[model samples]
Target: MAIIECSKMDKAINSLLSRQNYLVTQANDLARSFGNLTAFEHKVLDYCFSFVKAEDTSKQIYVVQMLDIIRHLGLNKSGKNYQRVAEAFQALNTKTALYLRTYKNGKNGIIMTSLFDYIEIIEDGKIEFQFSQKVAPYVFELKQNFYSFKLSELSNVRSKYALTLLKLWNANSMGKLNKATIKGTLEEWESWFLGSDNEGKPKRWSAGRFKQRVLSVSIDELGKLYPKNLFELTVEKSGRKVVGYRLDIIQPKLHCQIRHT
Candidate 1:
C-alpha cells in the first residue's frame, strides 16, 4: 500500500512537471514568432521612442542599435506580416506620441501628475481624484444603490439588537436603582440614577465598565431576550471574583443606549 501511494505521488509530480515544460515551450515559440520579442522589448522600444527626434549623439546611437537588432532578427518582416506585432507597435507609437506631446506642452504638468499618483496626504483634510467623466454618473448610481441596500440591511440588523435590549431593560427594572440596569444601559441608567452631568453619552462607557454591566444582568434574562447560543460568560481577571458575559458569542453585538438628562 505504501509503495502504491509513493508511486501515485511520483506520477502526479511528473504530470505537473510535464505540463509546466509544455507551457514554457509554447511561450517561447509565441515570443520568437512575434518580432522575436520578449516583455523587455516593449520597454526598450519606449526608451528608444523617448528620443525619436533627438539630436543627442548618445540617444541617436542607442536608437540605431535597437533598430539594427530588430532588422538582424528579421523582426521588421515579422512585424509587417503578424497582426499581433503590428498592433503592439501601433499601441507603443500612439502612447509614445501622446507622452511626448504632453511633455512638450508642460514638463511640470507631467511631473505634478506623477507626484500626485505616488504621494498620499492624510492630515487635516481629505482629497481624492474624480472618477473618469464618462463613467462618473454610472459609478455614482451604482454606489448610491449599494449604500441604500447596505443601510437597509444595517437597519434590519440593528432592529434585532434593539429589540433584545428593550426586552432586557424591562425584564429586571427596579424603580430607581443607583447602579446600572442593563450593562449596555450604564450611561442612561447612571443619568437616571445620578444626574445629567454623570452620564453624557455611550462613548463614556469604558471596555471594563461595559463588560461588568453585561455580566451584572442575569444570564436567564439575556437568554430570554437575545438568542442564548449567541452569548457566552467566563471569569475575567481570574484572581478577582468578577465574571464577564459576552453577547453575540460568535459575532458579539453590544449596543449601548444613551439618554441625555
Candidate 2:
C-alpha cells in the first residue's frame, strides 16, 4: 500500500506521452470479459495506466481524481451528475474480470481474476486501487512481444471493437497471425470465441455470423482511432468460401502517405 500524489496522476495529461512513452499490456489473444471492455471503460483504464509504474512494485494503490478525469473526458466540470461516472467505475470494479494463463505442476492452467486487485471509491470525485501483483511481470517487465501505444491516442475511441483491435495490433499497428498475415480456416474461429470466456459456456459462431456480429461493424471505428491505413483488414477465401483475414498495417508516418496517395 502506497500513496501516489496528484502530481504523478496529472502526468497522464499534463505531460508528454510520445510514441515511445506508451502503456504496455500483456498479450492474450484469447482474452475476454476485460477484452470486451466498453469504450468508456477502456478510456478510464488508460487513464489509470498513466499512474502505474513498472519499476516500482510497491507503487500499487493509485489515487485518481474524478474531476480531472471528467474534464479530460469533456464532461461538465461543475455538474453533480455523478451517476454516469459512478457506473463507469463500477464496471471497472465489477466487469474487468479476466483469466490469466499460468503453469502449475508442469501443466497449463488459468487463474481467474479481476484487473484491479481491489478498488474503493473514496469520494464522489475520486477512487483508488491496486493492480494485481501476478500481472506485474507481464505488464511492467515486458521483454517479449506485448501490445502498446501512446495512452493519449486511446482516450477518444468510442467503440469497443476499436479498442480490442488496438490490443490485438502490434506496436507498428500490424495485424499479425503468429508473425505474418492472418489466414485461418473458418472453422478455427469458432473455438476462439468459444474460448474467449472461461465460464465454460462456449458460443458457437460461423464466419458469416461473426462478420455480421463483429467484423463489418468494426471498420469505421478503427479509422477514427488510427490516422488512416495505420491498420486495414482484408478477407482470405478458399475459392468462394471465406477462410480468414489478412491485416495490413504501416508506420505512423506512412499513414499520411497512404492517405495522400
Candidate 3:
C-alpha cells in the first residue's frame, strides 16, 4: 500500500483554483497588442488564463493537470504529449504581447506591458504559472468588450489564421461588426488578424495573394473545427476575382445552445 503526499504549495494551488468551464480572455483598446501566436500556443495560453487568480495581486501559482491539457488538445497521454505541452509553454514564454493603456495626457501612446510572468512544470504531470496583475482585470473583470468562449471548444482549431479571425471578430462589440463583416476587404482583414504597428502599418498581404494563400484555406479549416456551424464563411467575389469576405454568425455551438429536456 502507498500513500500520496500533497505539499503545501499543491494544497494552496488546489484551494485557489476554481473549476470554471469557459476560458475567458479580453482584448480592449489597452490590451490589443499581439505577436501572432500559433494554434497550440494560443489555445494553451487561454487554458492557463481560465485558472487565473483574479483576487490575487501578488503572484499566485495555479496548478493545471496535464491530462486536462492533453484531452483539451486532443493528444494522447504520452511522453510526446508532455514534450509538446512543454514546447507550447516554451513558445508562449518568449512570445510577448504588449498592453497599451492611455493616460490622462495621452501624450503619444507608448506604455508596454507583459502578459505572462513565468511557468513551471511540476510533479504528477501538473504545471504552474502566474500572469501579470495588469492583465487580471481585463481577463476576470467584466467589460463591454470582453471575449470569452469554451476552453474545450477551441481544441480542434488547427488553422492559425482562422482562429485569429475568430479572436478579432469577438474583440469588437457584435453590432458595428456586422458592417465590418459585410465590407470585409482583404487589407482590413489582414490588419485585424496580423495587427499593425504604432505607426498603423500592417504586414503586407494583397487581396489576390491572400485569397489564394490564407483566405480560402482558413475558411475551410474553420469549417472543420468543432461546433460545426462555427461561422458562415462567405467569400464575396467580383467576377471570379475574390474581392472580399463576410463572416456571418451561425450561432456557434460554444456560444449559443438550446437545452432540450
Candidate 4:
C-alpha cells in the first residue's frame, strides 16, 4: 500500500475546492449557510427547491399539493401523515434561515435572511409558498447547478447530516466528475453539520466529537446510499491541534445523475 503525506493531500484538496468556487457559486454558499433545520425540514426544503425552474425568478410562487409531498415520502394518505407534513412545513418556514457573505463598496458585509418569504398550508390539501427574494437566486442556482437528485431520490434519507453532506457533495462536484473532494476548516465542518445556535453562531465541537457525530455518521449513511462509491476522510492538524477536514469521494462513472427540471 502507498502512504500519502497529510500536507500533500491537504494542498491538493484545498486546490480542488478553491477552483470549484466559480462553478459552485450561490449553491455552495447556501449549502453551508443554514444551521437549525431538522432532517424532515431539510427534506421539505428540497421538495420546495424541486419546483424552481431554469426560467423562474424569485417572484414566482410555487403551489404543491400536500398529498404529492406525502406520496413523495412514500407514505399513505392519512391524517397523521398529513399533520406531520404540515408541521414540517411550519418548521421550514421558521427554521430556514440563511447567512450569506457579500462585498460592496470595497467593504465586506453579511446578509441575514430567511429562505422563504411566506408559506401557507391549507387544510390537508395543498401548500402555497415563495422563496425569499434575497434567497431565490440561490434556490434557482441550486436547482440548475447543484441539484443532482430529485425529491424522490432523497425520500429514504433520515439524517439531516447525511442530507446536508449530499448537498455539499453535489455543490462541489462538477457534472459527471468521477472524483470529488470537500475541504473545510473544522469550524466550517461544524457549521455545515450542527449549524448555529439561537444566537446565530455556529455551534462548537471538538475535532473528535465532530468526526464521530458528524463525519462518521454522514459517511455511514451515504455508504448505504451509494454502495459502489468510496469515501475517505482525512484530518488536518497543526502540531497537536486539529484544523480542518477533507472528504474524498470516488464515484462510479454511471451513478445517479438525475437533475430536477
> Model 1: what TM-score?
0.17
Candidate 2 regions off by >4 Å? Answer: 1-33, 78-81, 141-148, 170-206, 224-230, 237-243, 252-261
RMSD of 2: 13.2
Candidate 1's error at 168, in angstroms? Answer: 13
- Candidate 2 lDDT over residue span 64-132, tens digit each: 888878867778865564556667788777655555655568544445556678777776567887877
What lDDT does each candidate get? 0.29, 0.54, 0.56, 0.75
Superior by TM-score: candidate 1 or candidate 3: 3
- Which candidate would rank higher by lDDT, 3 or 4? 4
Off by over 4 Å in 1: 1-219, 226-230, 241-261
Candidate 3: residue 59 lDDT (0-100): 56
- Model 2 poorest ten-residue lDDT run: 15-24
Candidate 2's C-alpha lDDT? Answer: 0.54
The candidate, 2 or 3, that scores higher on TM-score is 2
Native-to-model Cα distance after best TM-score fit, residue 93 in candidate 3, in Å: 1.6
Give one digit per residue, the lDDT tens place, for model 1 in 134-239.
2223223332221112222222322222323332332223211111133323333322222222122213345366444533343334344345223334433334
Q: What's the TM-score of every candidate structure?
A: 0.17, 0.66, 0.62, 0.81
Q: Of the candidates numbered 2 and 4, which has the greater lDDT value? A: 4
Error of model 4, residue 247, in angstroms: 0.7
What order do you get sorting by TM-score, best first? 4, 2, 3, 1
Error of 1 at 10 (Å): 64
Runs in model 3 deviating more than 4 A are: 1-35, 52-60, 105-108, 141-145, 173-188, 191-202, 223-261
